[model samples]
Target: MSKNILIVDDSMSLRQVVSIALTGAGYNVIEAGDGNEALTKLNGDKIHLIVSDVNMPGMDGITFVSHVKQDANYKFTPIIMLTTESQQEMIQKGKELGVKAWLVKPFKPEQMLDAVSKLILP
Candidate 1:
């Protein structure tokens, strides 16, 4: 199956890079600049997984994840934090909000693909 994946980041470069990588890997990619954009896209698309950056201009990744998990309609869609924050507290907070995985920034395409495959396919 071609998975529909959402990539949310405030960095335009990061969003482009990740979107390209995921598209090349055969997944349908949706790019969002911030949490609000991500949520808007979620309303119209059937996204299988969400990869988001922790820090954003409006509605951070942590807040986004909490909102997504709280919404009964999208509670089952898996989310992974792909950010520069390696702090344990931040990771724990993400887990509390129902994030499936946490990946530190400067990630390789292989690493992102691996995590997505594991979450979506397993």
Candidate 2:
């Protein structure tokens, strides 16, 4: 079965780009506008991985990740932070929250696919 990947970002264009890339690679893609919407998408479905942006309108990536980590259903799911923020402190915080990888904005789709392949659950 194809793995499900949830992509959370404020930019619709960014989400579309990522969704196309992931779906083309044979994975199922779920999209959300921001952290709040992303949480709603977590409705007991088996999401193999999550791609999130650090800066969003509703809730930030770090806070969203913390909430995810605390949930038993998705606590172990791998997460990749895809954002423009390259600050060390933000990266460190994400690492502490169990983020699997950090991909800065303007990343190549191939790079993201590589990270997804490496981290997505079998």
The local distance difference test score of each candidate is 0.89, 0.94
Which portions of model 2 show Cα errors greater than 4 Å? none
Per-residue lDDT of 54 in model 1: 97
TM-scores for all candidates? 0.94, 0.97
Which run of 10 residues does model 2 get worst, by summed lDDT? 57-66
Give the alpha carbon lDDT tens digit for every residue of 1-122 in model 1.
68889899999999898998889989988889999988898785577888999999989998888888888778999888999999999999988888999999899999988998899853
Show the lowest summed lDDT stretch of 10 residues, model 1.
38-47
Which candidate comes out best when scored by TM-score? 2
In candidate 1, residue 25 scores what lDDT?
88
Q: Count of backbone clashes for each model?
A: 0, 0
Write model 2 residue lDDT over 33-108, tens digit each, in one string: 8889999999999999999999998998888999999999999999999999999998998899899999999989
- Give every collision pair in model 2: none
Q: Give candidate 1's root-mean-square deviation (CA, Å).
A: 1.3
Off by over 4 Å in 1: none
Tally clashing residue pairs in candidate 1.
Answer: 0
